[model samples]
Target: MRNREETYGLIVETAYKMFAENGFDKTSLAMIAKEVGISKPAIYYYFDSKEKLIDFLFDEICKEIMDQYAFTVEDLTVNNFEQYLLTIGFQMIEEQEKDVHFNKIFNEYILLATRKERYMKQLNKIQKGYFESFSMLMNHGVTIGAINQENVESKSNMLAMVIDNIGNFILTGLELDYKGIWKEAVKSVLLSVRND
Candidate 1:
């Protein structure tokens, strides 16, 4: 079972690199199999299709991004929230900007999702999970008297939108001051919800 899991990991990693370099539509299961030095059948055994493989890869990447934030609801005090938004949030944007290939592949997947119901569903699930994470953080801020209690849901949604836009800008390879823009946007959201 352990060896099988390792092989599965290898397949996913190989597929991600290939898709990043060559694109999702252009990268084939056979190519991934070859890169992993496994048979195409082995790839099929783990993931029935390329779309399934991409979905798994996307989930893994999202988990990594979430993990990078390294903050929880308990960490949402006024001081901590500002520090996190400035430090960890900026770090997340910077890390994302460095992954040019992955960003390209991500944007491509988003575009493809618009045309395919399965892809759309998968994307929606990932997005909802991210939004919930932001909402949880906002709820904690309210509890700690760092944020206004009025319209917590709307404030959370707005903050989440700012984060999403920053990510989208990075993923689309927009030539702008991402960190500066992110800081400004986050500050704006925080000011809007400030308890003072």
Candidate 2:
């Protein structure tokens, strides 16, 4: 049973890599099976279909991001929301760097419209939840004099959009300087909110 579970993990990881390298639409079960050194029938033992495999990969990545975000924000206090924002963004960038396939999969999701309406709806909800969570933190910052209270939601959304766009830029193109871009965006946001 342990070996069976390990093999399943391997198949999932291999399929994730293949899907990352190739877009979701282009990745086929046969291709993933070949890459994993398994017969197509063996692949079926793990995932019923290519769509299911993709869904599993998407769920895995989102779970990882949320877990990492939770850990990163665990010690954060509301007084320094700007710092926390930068810390969380940079931590996400760091975690993302550890896996190239993760970026590919993430980029694919941002670029591709899901054929499954439920997944598409869930995606929007997840994105909005993240934005709202950060905005609430920023609102706390207002009470503590860390952020401007005026138009808090709009400003929070704008700040979050900067991070999101920078992430997309880094993941989609190798020519871009990801580290520098991430740092610059964080710095820019901090400067905008600084009491000075």
Candidate 3:
């Protein structure tokens, strides 16, 4: 005798686990229904189609991570820009390690986004938000004389790439010194534009 909300939440949770472990390609409505102890039609009651479910998960992932890292440029000192990059990099690694299921689903969505218009819009909105934040931070750095204004957009793009991919180190469970590597990357990409 579950309410609609409980059943819907249960479906999402079960689907996330199944997709993360078995992959999205192999998962089917029948499989999800079997796992959730619901009929296939029951799943349709919550999600019209698999695509809609993926869309829902995409939003879920976006909301889950986008809520973090909300900081004003005024709160950040230009001198701490390198540490800022490190914080973003470390956060990615920590998050991926904390929930491999979430990380796997995120990667799957990234691949799907390439071919789906809806996913592209969602992904673009998320990335645009991050790009704007990085660009503004770099602009602030330049204003404070910590960095130059040259190539602000390109530099922001590079930093955003680093933040997005630094989580791979944890995904691979690599034993190398990732912090050392990230520090080198930050110095090369960002500190290279220092005004001083």
Candidate 4:
């Protein structure tokens, strides 16, 4: 009774659930079809293979990050650049907690990153985008003398590393005590930016 769009939605939704529950490698299309109460052939009508399903999910997660970037940086300018980064970090942690796929993804990708270079490329792209955004913000800050003009690349890379490390920690179920860890980490990163 479902339309093609509905069937595709069901397939994606079902696969997402299974992937979250058992991770990408453990989850199978047959299991997803069973979970959706559909035949494997029927499921294939929507998703031809598990890799295709994962590809779709990967894009979906990347889109979520891209979408959040808009809201997180909407009103950000040179004056409040630090606050902008902090806001985005905290918001991302909260959003990652709400979505099981996000958490599963961190675990899955980190565990298999070396063996999965193509998928890892997606992760790299997202991280680089984050860095570029921060670099632009830092450049603006320098223009206004709020931040240093020298060593922009180094400063941006360090900031990006801090954020990436934080995300990795959170994904590992490490209690960051954000208020404590973030303040110190931010200060250190800013010191590098200001050093220039």
For each candidate, the alpha-carbon lDDT, in order, equals 0.75, 0.70, 0.76, 0.71
Cα-based lDDT at residue 130, candidate 2:
69
Tens digits of lDDT, candidate 1, 55-152: 78877766675575445666467777866766756877777777766677777778878888876887687777777877777778778767777877
Give the candidates in order of TM-score, highest first.
2, 3, 4, 1
Model 4 spans > 4 angstroms off? 1-7, 68-78, 110-113, 189-196
lDDT of 3 by residue, 1-196 (tens): 9889988999999989888878889998789989988899889999989877877887888897676545466656666766776776677666766787876777788888788888788878888888887777778777776666777778777877776666765666677766676677667656656534
Q: How close to the true structure is residue 161 of candidate 4, measured as C-alpha lDDT?
A: 70
TM-scores of the models, in the order given: 0.73, 0.80, 0.78, 0.78
Model 3 poorest 10 in a row by lDDT: 67-76
Write down the TM-score for model 1: 0.73
TM-score of 4: 0.78
Query: Could you report the Cα RMSD, in angstroms, for every candidate shown?
Result: 3.8, 3.2, 3.0, 3.3
Ranking of predictions according to lDDT: 3, 1, 4, 2
Winner by TM-score between candidate 4 and candidate 1: 4
**RMSD of model 2 against the true structure:** 3.2
Error of 1 at 195 (Å): 8.8
Selected candidate, larger lDDT, 1 vs 2? 1
Residue pairs with backbone atoms closer than 3 Å in model 3 (clashes): none
- Please list all clashing residue pairs in model 1, or write none if there are none: none
Scored by Cα lDDT, where does model 1 land?
0.75
Error of 3 at 125 (Å): 3.4
